[model samples]
Target chain A: MSHSFRVEATADRLPEANAGLDAWWSGAGLPDEARFAFELVLEEIFMNVVMHGSPPEGAPCMVDVILDRQGDGVVMEIADDGLPFDPLAMESPDTAAPMEDRRVGGLGVYLVREMMDTVHYRHSEGRNRLSVFKSIGST
Target chain B: MNVNIESTEGGVSVARAHGRLDFGASAEFQKALEGAVGAKPKALVIECSELEYVSSAGLRAFLVAARAAKAGGVGFAACALQPAVKEVFEVSGFSKIIDVQADLATALAALA
Candidate 1:
């Protein structure tokens, strides 16, 4: 079973897309830990597409989020059709930099990696899709 | 996310924070922190023990609070952040600008 939502690549719609996942989780009885993992990773993935996905103001893309219980673990896949960029390749934000010296962004992706059990990305069909999985017991 | 806050007779305000501190909640967090500092408290203590996660936006929110408190001649300090969150503060070098403490009691006194 899978549900899909198409959203414009914009920051304002980020939360809306997230809420869809929350609703799905609630109905499926997803645990708190797994829920958090999905929220974080999805935010990072979705926002990246919004921020850098298209022409900075191009057409919105479709996101297909599938929530299925795979042996007590939940699998979430995020697909975007704006641009071809993989978040896993992005450099880690420099924690050592002073406040004034630190880059303005990039911490979101790093934190996502820290909190998730597994993350994978692939660019095909001119779309970037990322899949994340976490065991329910991990929470 | 909920912020548990109370003001002491000494004019000090302390906030107990629980939940992930990220961009999603940064707006609300910034508002609450500013509201506390606006009361002209002598000091501010942020209990972050229960605070799960924080991003750079979270750090910016704290900076906004600190800057406001500084303008008011009061002080601000953050306490007991989770290791991962703490690492973020450390990575962004927020530890240097924002005074981080081991516990609420310690943060309260740090301003004294």
Candidate 2:
């Protein structure tokens, strides 16, 4: 089964988007760990679009999300009509760094990469498309 | 997220966080934690038994608070994380840089 939705790329809309995603995942009877991974990954990518991918002219930006359960794993695809940026290309944060030397904000993409089984990014037709997959029982 | 701050007799400030700490709630949570650190208690312990969820944005709040506590010469630790939150911490390697105790009692005792 697959669930699809669209959300405005604004901080204020995040809760609503999360609520909708949670409701769908719950109804689908996903395991607790799978649900948690999906929630975290979605939030990471969505917030990145809201924060760094928006246009400079204050144009309205929107993100499209699709979540699908395929056999023993789940796939999530997020497409945002924002700047052409590839999140997968970003450098991984140094997780072994000491607290005093660690950069505060770079851990989001790194966490997403670590938690998900696979992540792919593409920029096509003026949109940033990111797809992630995770097995249900891996967690 | 709802963060209730209180003080122990040992001058440790314990902030208990409940509910989801995602992108939407991160800013407010960060301010609350930073405020707790700004008070300059002997130590700061975050009680996370009731915290249901946390994303990377929420993790950033913890990072900022940890840095502030270190800079201000205050001890810091977090305890009783739910499984999902614990997973996030481990994957992000926050369990290394930040002090993580098994429970509230252990957290307080470690700081003592």
| Top model number, TM-score | 2
Poorest 10 consecutive residues by lDDT, candidate 2 chain A: A25-34
DockQ of candidate 1 (2 decimals)? 0.31
Specify the CAPRI tier of model 1: acceptable
Q: Which lDDT tens digits does candidate 1 get at residues A8-126?
A: 66777767877888888887766654566577677667778767777755476666666666665787888877768888888986766644455646677776676667788898888
- For model 1, the stretches where C-alpha displacement exceeds 4 angstroms are A1-4, A98-100, B1-7, B15-24, B31-42, B47-56, B63-74, B79-103
Candidate 2's C-alpha runs over 4 A off are none
- TM-scores, one per candidate: 0.72, 0.95
lDDT per residue (tens digit) for residues B1-112 in model 1: 6787898766779998898776678889989999999888898888898888665567778878888887788888889987766776765567887889988778767777
DockQ of each two-chain model? 0.31, 0.86
